[model samples]
Target: MAESENGATQPQQPQQAPKMNVLAQFVRDLSFENILSQKGAGGDVQPDVQVQVNLDAKKRSVENQYEVVLKLKVDSKSKSNGAQLFLLELDYVGVFNIENVPEDQLHPFLLIECPRMLFPFARRIVSDMSRDGGFPPLNLEMIDFLALYRAEIQRRQAATQAEASNAPTQ
Candidate 1:
């Protein structure tokens, strides 16, 4: 309420909070190989596992829709002999309907928030695949998506700077 020349009540518009919904989620591709079984090597050996993650997001044809893909690669090896034990690669896709987010914040939201939403399912798939393949269930640790996003941005900026410096003095 405000007093103009004559006192009158004014209606204030409310700001809408950012909204996001998962329209669909699916596994685009999955591969699991139990190398130890294939090689007939069985013993009480310690496992060394390595994991890599990549993320990509793009706008969809439908209004306010976006598709985000999370790619994961896991490799396990025997700690003693360094022999390969198992390999797992998975590509997960999520379709989201998002609204009311500012343009500058959309990229991070898509990469960080969307993947965070999909990670639990992806992790479960990995655990099941590993267990089904004969070894113990491989429970993946929680990933810090915000840190990953920031590191990627820093890497790109560094690459751009290096390219500019090596531009043959143009």
Candidate 2:
């Protein structure tokens, strides 16, 4: 409550600092596959490994809080022989409490920042799974989430433009 200059009482807006909190995090799904399981290591199989990564986020509003779930998928294949050496898929979820952030900025923040916070753990899981599956430890390099986000946006824009151009003109 605030008092006006004329001595009349009035309601004041609540003050809140911008904040983001991780309420909880969990692995919703995980899968690991070793395609060359039957064929034991016979010779020096120089691994021609290929890796792919993808990210997604969704916001769930529960009362005053928001839950941001980050979904990630990683796949590895041997390019030399076109065999999938290993495939890893994981859906890591994070429940976040977001406050005071502008609507325009929320989407980027959720997709970029939240995934950054979750990547190390996911990387560890991938590394461990590869080693435990009787292969050398896979040390995943750091991901550039911002660059990835930008690329995705550009791709979407290009696709939209292509669709619009292909539509029947009025």
Candidate 3:
């Protein structure tokens, strides 16, 4: 209850922070590698970065938290000397609480928001590592989370519809 302008008592707003029935920020996996390739082991050179990103979401059995893992593999070789400069593999993860969320919402949260949060940190690591490793920094291309999420959702829905159509008639 609250006091009104005229001194009348009124109902008060409810207390307690809104329950975020979603995943909080967390890390499921992280790896930074600076491995020199076979060709560059004995030579001086810069690595050509080839970055591959794989995204997926899985539920944790006990706590019900979802783990979104972004696997990045960077393969680089020297342009001048044709030597292996650095082959970096970064497996980044964002732990999200996904309780009480619908299936459609879950996909968006994992594909878009989770990756958006993790990308900057991962980008910094890759850039800094190459800079400190005696080579030009590698700048990764920006990821399109919206497109990816839509594709995944469409793919899942299609599969679901197909399965339903193929079911035995009652």
Candidate 4:
């Protein structure tokens, strides 16, 4: 046991970082609504879908856990006459337990890995909703979340640069 000149006690050994662990992970909530197609579509409907998806992730806590929400909307229409076929929205959220991950680097795991993990389940729901809405068993294609996120980042960066350039020289 030794004390420094400032009268502060020092440990004989260096302290180690906290150990991380995974606690729990599962789908918290899911919803698929075929509101329009369920009510208005008729037989002999040959439809084309306009699909859109959005992904978001957040660290629910610092204790190695997070939440990611995958949202998709499909607006299907008859190709021949441009008549409305069906409008469906699928919003699914999944909770993930990520442990031992550094704070600064957790973003990629959220924007990239978490969404990637949740896509398949979300895709299945999309297809099933279309089938359950009186159409054939739909086969929704896979999505590239990394590409989407990169594109968004690029767009934002360009906009910021442009704004900075356009700002009055002061």
Candidate 5:
């Protein structure tokens, strides 16, 4: 503690700037399936591709380290024949070191920023996997993680409100 000229102690100052880092990233799990015969898969028919993205975070320590995982699930089916074309599941994990982020802001940072950092690698993997599986490369569109997070929160809030309303009145 430091004392002022009049003997009042000065508040401690933060020792460092806000810091966020991607310590490491890796593919935790990857699965790809090609559902049609290699020769004529989706040749005549247009395939409908659906992609789902999910993000998860786990604190690594009492300090400011965390593990963020981005999961991508994709399915492609031929609309005309009702046949499956391809399916993919990927779990990409990143070890991050984050510090000085406020509690309220931390959740967004973990879900959005961390996953954004990991998306390119994960996307490349998906594209390569699809091409290697004898199909065209699957180019995933950019994800709006913040929107997804907000939407999920809104959904949970709506569910909670519905549950409260449905409860027996006191």
Candidate 6:
């Protein structure tokens, strides 16, 4: 107990723990193309696959709720002759109810944590889509959302600085 001006003892209040819950998750859009089948190319070929990921988050009309979308693009090409093999695009969305998080930290929490929760489902969809599209099952590597967020912040800072430098003096 700390001494006050009147030497009165006071009890300290405990802080509330942060809360997060996924209200729903679904695929907003999906597309797959079997290029090798379309081209009728039949031959043994080594496959080189590339994956890209993007994220978006927005506040919902309801309080303490947000929508996050994870966009993924997968492309496969023949290593031997660089012929297109297949392509897949997916937009997975999740609705989250979050509370007790600080306002300053909510943006990062949504972009990083919410998508992390939804990635396994998205990965499975990609695998199934590739197999169904007449190609081998494609398993995607885990993403580093924290690194991505840091890089995006740096990019935005650089762009803002460049714009400030390029602005004409009045």
lDDT of each: 0.96, 0.74, 0.70, 0.71, 0.89, 0.93
Which ranges of candidate 6 are over 4 A from the true structure? 1-9
Top candidate on lDDT is: 1
List TM-scores for all candidates, in order: 0.92, 0.81, 0.60, 0.73, 0.87, 0.92
Q: Which tens-of-lDDT digit does each residue in 13-72 have in candidate 1? A: 676899999999999999999999899989887999999999999999999999999999
Worst window of 10 by summed lDDT in candidate 6: 9-18
Clashing pairs in 4: none
For model 6 the TM-score comes to: 0.92
Model 4 weakest lDDT span, ten residues long: 18-27
Instruction: For model 2, give the 10-residue run with minimal summed lDDT.
Output: 38-47
> RMSDs, each prediction?
2.6, 3.6, 7.2, 5.8, 3.0, 1.9
Candidate 4, residue 78: how far the Cα is off, in Å: 1.5
How much lDDT does candidate 1 score?
Answer: 0.96
Candidate 4 lDDT over 18-109, as tens digits, reads 34333444444544455445666566757788888887777775556677777787887788778777677766787777756667867766
The sequence of per-residue lDDT tens digits that candidate 2 reaches over residues 1-170 is 79999999999987677788888888888888776775553343456655666666666758435555555555555556766666777777777777787889888888788788888887788789889976888888988889988999999999999999999987
TM-score: which is higher, 1 or 4? 1
| Model 1 alpha-carbon drift over 4 Å, by segment | 1-12
Model 5 is weakest, by summed lDDT over 10 consecutive residues, at 37-46
In model 2, pairs of residues that clash are none
Estimate, for each residue in 1-170, the C-alpha lDDT of model 3 and write its tens digit.
78999999999975543222444444445444455543246545545667777788887885647778877777776687655566767777777665555655666766787788778877877777777765577788888878877887799899999999999998
For residues 37-147, could you state the per-residue lDDT of candidate 5 as single tens digits?
653544566779999998899998657889999999999888887688888999999999998888898999999889989999999999999899887888899998889
User: Candidate 2 — which residues are off by over 4 angstroms?
Assistant: 1-17, 40-42
Which residue pairs in model 6 clash with each other? none
